[model samples]
Target: MTDSSAAPLRGGAVGIVTATLAVAAHGMAGGGWADGSALALLIVVSIGIGAMTALPERSTVLLLPALMAGQLLAHIALSLGAAEMHNHSLLPSTAMIAFHAAASVIAGLMIAAAERLYGPITSIVRAVLALLTPLPDGSAVGRVSMSVAVPSVDGTALDWVISRRGPPVSVY
Candidate 1:
């Protein structure tokens, strides 16, 4: 894909991943889910975070901060945005904050590494596939074709095989 298309794709990927991880981490750490208006607001916040970090170049410096900020904002949004059923407190405990921080760092590192290596890895895979793919004409490069001497024209399967030499020969 072109660089222009790639920018939006990468941005969307980062945004979606950040939002998913934040929400998952919040729930996994025993933080109650905030539905209704809170959920809507969190989506907006995540999109904003993604837009802010949407650069064509791979940058851990930018992505890490964006991810960290997204996580923090998500936490606050969920904590304070819950309805009566959730009843979550606005202030999080030390452990909860620590969990979010740790998750943010680990996830950020992984995402950054993947983004940094994506281009090179994709090129390598494409090169390998190209090398392994067969030619359109079904002929091998630098191969010499040999003529076979037929004593007689016999209507047999062997005659079919003998007509075409090398890899393209078929007995069917």
Candidate 2:
């Protein structure tokens, strides 16, 4: 059977793809090579973030900084391009970059949280099923132990669901 642990990684991948495509579409309508190229680079950085989060074991502490760095790099590229073309001022560029960075970081965190939460939520559901229905041994109907481990802000909690039959079926 496929391991359930990979679901979060898959979700992160989907988030990255969505972010990249959104930026690509924006770049396409941006009406200049500089803007388009800058957005393209941002997409590359988003891919990196996706890759980092795609690992089976990822450190949540590093997520913020990684995302910030990616945003800063993309912003710098865009700012420089705009300056060379004289299409935008440094002040406005900086403001826009900050806004975009904040938005991106917030979106990334939300995506991560959703992905992380999926396991426990689904496990809780399954545990409920186990409790409500009889198993082959008829032991799970009334003797089920259901627990949901919610993650903390830093992602330093054991997020799992445990349903006991003859043995424990834990999804973490």
By TM-score, the best candidate is: 1
- Candidate 1 residues lying further than 4 Å off, grouped into runs, are 1-10, 86-88, 132-172
lDDT of 1 by residue, 69-123 (tens): 8888877777666656454576667767777788778877776666666777788
lDDT agreement of model 1 with the native: 0.72
User: Which pairs clash in the backbone of model 1?
Assistant: none
* TM-score, model 2 to reference: 0.46
Best by lDDT: 1
- Candidate 2 runs further than 4 Å off: 1-39, 76-92, 125-172
Query: What's each prediction's TM-score?
Result: 0.64, 0.46
Clashing pairs in 2: none
Clashes of each: 0, 0
